[model samples]
Target: MKQKMLAKAVGIALVMAPLASQAAVENIQYFGYAKWGNIYTDNDDHNNGKGERNDVIRASEGYGNYRLGNELNWWEAGLKADVWQDGDAYFDTTLYLGSGESWGDVSIIQMWSAGHGLFASQPNAKVWAGERFYRRHEVHMIDIKYWDTSSTGIGIEDWDLGFGSGHIAWMAPNSSADGRSLHNIDARISDIAISDTADLTFGLNYIFTQNSSYEESDITTSGAMLSALYRQAWDYGSNTFAFQYGTNALAGGLMSAEGGSNRKYSTGVEHDGYSWRVFNSGDLNVNEDFQVMYSIAYQDKNLDNNDGEKWFSVGARPQYSWTDYMATALEVGYETVEAQNGAGTNDMYKVTVAQMFQAGKGVWARPSLRIFATYSEKNDEWNRGGDTYGTAMRNASGKDSVDEVTFGFNVETWW
Candidate 1:
């Protein structure tokens, strides 16, 4: 009896020891967010030539298209796990899942590792490889990822420079063709303070490709972009100004889009062109109960042998808190676009009134439920024979103008 008991105890100890050791080497975490709601519109079928059930309330900002429950619009969720860690070195991965016509699948969006003091004497200097989000910056309201350099490759971040910290990275597109590939070099200098309340950042991105699908010649195609940003912080809010310029293919933002049809210009077409943009966003606190958020942007695209396009947009949102958990808000936006070749020019405007419920009265409060009513209008050019909106409107109601009213509830939170 004693010998049998001893054997069993030894086996259990051996199993438990390995389990404990494994636990010590790995740490895991999970995070995600979901936003869903129902919308009712007066022109669901564009019976008035307004448009085909325009569910989007306005074009102010955010991933609003993700909230539409149609095949193209659906909810999103993601999971992240910090699978391993040791001192300053660790491994992590993220998976993104969504349901929609645009995204109805699971994708491993992030998988990478990093460490400090591994390559140099800088305390926080780090090096990493694999696939990652790279350096993506955006304006939340406009839904514009102005500066995105994410790809599969390697990089060094937090390298100390005399004036500020710097980062350098290389990224490449995945391809199966023999001896054919597109690669980019992205570099930036960040956190260069000019004053107690202000700072600046600068970036350069360049791309070179061999045997690209967009090229007919046997030579390489190349492009480059430059960007600068200035930021100022005050007691109540913050302000940011950003500017960018590049050749048609030089702009990294356009290249990051997956499909050829998703690109700014048509696929398999070689064109010499230039693009530029200026953008500003800010927030202001009027007092203990009132606050305002605003943004404006102007962008231009020109090709050597094609008609150009230009866009201008502005928007503002103001909120008045009735109590710690209740608030009222008014949002207004306007946008105009023109084609250089006289294809057409269109204008749009929107307004929304909302009642919000949340944990606090602050402007940044989250986990909020909002009930809203939106009103929007578009010019005849956008209603008759324009793009998708115009085609849908003409097909549905054959109208030259549209007045739409929508009511819906939305809830948003993150942790």
Candidate 2:
């Protein structure tokens, strides 16, 4: 259905091309990103073909773990174009589609339009309606987006404040917000130059209660969140440190701080709870042949009902470029999680090494092909029966061992 809808959009655009030309409309080029890959366990009897991670038991909750060998197939692509530009006034629009493990599982992820140039004092100011992936941040190696407010609604962006630029948005709950009809407001300020070598960003989000309180039939609740990041740059690399806090229905382990409307529903419960996180990540270019990325993150979540979780993780991936288009990398990552008031703890460790063929020289180069091997192990607590992953996480022994070796190949590129 989504594919068919996009097809109709293209047809309508072609039919209106002549009228668009007369209206000063300009067509922008296409843009997209994609990563296609798979992994298989080496256990002869199991015949497993999935990416494994220590983060799996938590169902990939708060902070994510190492991504290289722990990722499956996924991709998203989109287009942007100018509707019309008449001197100080203009309009623009964007649309995109995303697919999950299977390409057939595709959906329209972004469809929005904006108008600009109306505010002469702030020529960069823009008012937009529809949906957009606005103001998102992620730790690449861990594949965790600590800050995100992407949703389907209306917003104003790029306001020039004296200290920094500012953004504000309203996300509706019709087909978004997991079908909850609550008022959601998100606001943030960024690009604040704290020093010659540092900058900062801070965001606030709120969700108003509509159904009074939580009942069997009513899942709506009031919530609030605050998030901030401090960024610094040096000659070889840059680093970003983040802190996030959320309360009640708007947070869980430092997320939903973005207001949770982008996904089908909140990844966490809608109970009265509090969540917070402290995290840091950086990418360094040691030399022409060696590059490394590292991160450390910790998050805590607790609910009034006495059920919650805590997560701590650290990982690094270092690559060496042998030539202009070839390199090798080893990724080592470790993670641990504790039930707020339940069990002791569980820990996981993983390591992977991949040989790569790429497009350019730097460690951050694009369009790379990687052939890799990985080893991962988990504590006995997770290996016990009746775990979240069940037998899928089991090893050949399947009795009390929770470890596996995997190998795979992937083609990853973005623009």
Candidate 3:
């Protein structure tokens, strides 16, 4: 208990340390997020919860994006700086290194490479996968990333891209049983073009990995992903229209554990005045014997099979702004995933809603409140020819699917 409290204190101190610089710089700006929340998992044991529990508060700074340094000149020079939380662990630093350029703006330190996926995908649908209380997970490792934006010349704005290489380990210690240590490297490019009604963006990434546990020890595996997005604001008097599409693919060794090649496609559309959006994601397992090896124990297992699973999801999200400081949002989604090999199949349904309010610019320094809820179900069936298998997998923690209500306050600023 004392150790946890001490860690919290240290975190608070580190965050405040940057505030001291605010007094000296004329053009410096500071901003961040701080909140206290709890977790009540239906499957308490799923995320190493000893038992039913209540955590007082968990403070998070910037979600995962970190801003480290400031540029004095538009495209002449600047330094690298950032201090943000990765899950529960915080990385604090303001180092001026790796200086360069692509189009116009000066480059600081390389944070993201071109070889890794660019988009920010959500975690698993499970809460346990969504929350990280005390562990520092999802740390970013960049081999080298530099950017430039002067290529567009005066009046026209260009984009900045980066290239990097490094290995991806799930956590700090790399403890997964089926963990693969590879000499993988990826690159990324973003902020392409800023036009009146249209913008273009693209990214490509590749990963090469190896599993030492295999009999051959030299299992060279590789995968790549490409993404392109374009959004235009259409003027229809009181309303507007926008659309987006993205696709990803994984081949080679990554397909070994899951069976075959892995591919996913997603697209979304929204309107200007209307606070509603429609989107869909489709996943396809190209191999018949690809299985994902997961465990409640966090242990690795042999995940080879004679069948595969393919699923698709469709959802709608609508939000309304009651006042400049108050709003309400609702979401409904349905997804179905199935494996064919005479083994079994699983299907799921989900619905969620949230009402949020703010006192001062969405900050709790004065105080704000948000209410949210979600309900989900998973039905499983196993039938091999005329033979019937065991029952489906269910939440063993004794609670139905899972339910919870989160209430919290945030205190921070950005400039």
Candidate 4:
């Protein structure tokens, strides 16, 4: 499907090339990203083999965009697709055509709800998620949205406010959200805005979601959410300050023994041009089962700044370019996942270093050498033990996480 789609797009571009030279023609663009690397982990317990074929090395993504009449007076459309070696695929596209004038830009298009964009922004970057493995796809279905911007009259340094409303596939219900079905139908309006400041910035997002999570019985759930973020860069002092707060309604499994909201707050800073960065996510639960991470890089330019496809979640990485096609990075991180309310606390530590090299162009080939090691203070951190106390996390497929080395290469390409 992806190859055929790309070929069709190219064929159209070729046919339109001559037309573009004479008359108005839609401009089409194509791009893709690919990465592959060897991965290894050691747990000291050889239940799983070391130097195993790292399955994390195969992934590809591509996107296409077309614009009519060149500028802001016409129509636009975009399509994106991603496929992983592990047999996972994602397809998303949008088409909008409208004109901009005194009434603010208006367009009718199938796109992500304002709420969806806000909620997804919580993740730090493109690559990293809370866990090592990708979560099941949970996103809204197709919906029509009305967007309007150009309304604020703040000044030279004015703020930009955008609003959109539409129906979408809600992720709160279904077996994925626990065995509860709230008969939730997607119908919601979301508003979002970004404030501009010479040295500071802030963003606000609000969503009016309906027919939220459900329960086996007649338990009804519906509500709203508000998220705000602020950041300031102290260029003279070479420092930065940031803070974020968000409140979300809870139902079904997320509902605590006592009804309350599921909220999160975080703050952190960095200096010396991002040689260091720190961030932490905290939960509203009294137990405060949160995750904290701090990372420091040895390179001058943060690897993240140079990364074409930012892949880590905890934060950006700094890479050393050995050559145009090769680079290496050393990363070490410590994470704290507080034991459950009744369970004692357990801490886990991990350290990884990898050297990656790339070859080819379209589907550039990549290979890397990596060493990953993880250990828990209480052995039960990742459920090393069986169903004992619900603490162990087992990977019978791979060896332990204490000390292991992986060596492999992944070849991938995109249109």
Per-model CA lDDT versus the true structure:
0.61, 0.71, 0.27, 0.24
Model 4, which residues run further than 4 Å from truth?
A: 1-25, 38-220, 223-225, 231-318, 322-326, 357-403, 407-415
lDDT of 1 by residue, 1-415 (tens): 6675567557545633443455543444455554555556677554355443434533211111112111113454454444456565555545444443223232445556665456536867777787776877766555455676666789888898978899999987532222346677889999898999999999988776645654356222666788899999999889999999977455223332111113322213344577788879888888889998788877776766444456677888888999999999887877766654555556667777888898788556787688877777765342323331111122233224667777677776655
Who is ahead in TM-score, 1 or 2?
2
Q: Per-residue lDDT for 1-415 in model 4, tens only?
A: 6676567557556643443353322233343322223333343233356534322110011000000000012223332222212212222222222323212333332222111112232221122111110111110000000011111111111112234222223232322222333222222222322323223333332222233333333222232222122232232212223222222221111111110011100001010011111222211111112112222111111211121111111222234555556555443333232222222223223334445554421111233322232222212222324321122333344322232343333333233
- Candidate 3 residues lying further than 4 Å off, grouped into runs, are 11-28, 33-180, 189-195, 210-214, 217-220, 235-308, 340-342, 359-368, 382-415
The regions of model 2 sitting more than 4 angstroms off are 1-24, 43-63, 173-178, 209-220, 253-270, 380-400
lDDT of 1: 0.61
Q: Report the candidate with higher lDDT, 1 versus 4.
A: 1
Which candidate has the highest TM-score of all?
2
Worst 10 residues of 4 by lDDT: 62-71
Model 3 C-alpha lDDT per residue in residues 33-54, reported as the tens digit of each score: 2222332335454337643223
Q: CA shift at 127, candidate 2, in angstroms?
A: 0.6
How many backbone overlaps does candidate 4 show? 18
Global CA lDDT computed for model 3: 0.27
TM-score of 2: 0.84
Poorest lDDT segment (10 consecutive residues) of candidate 1: 62-71
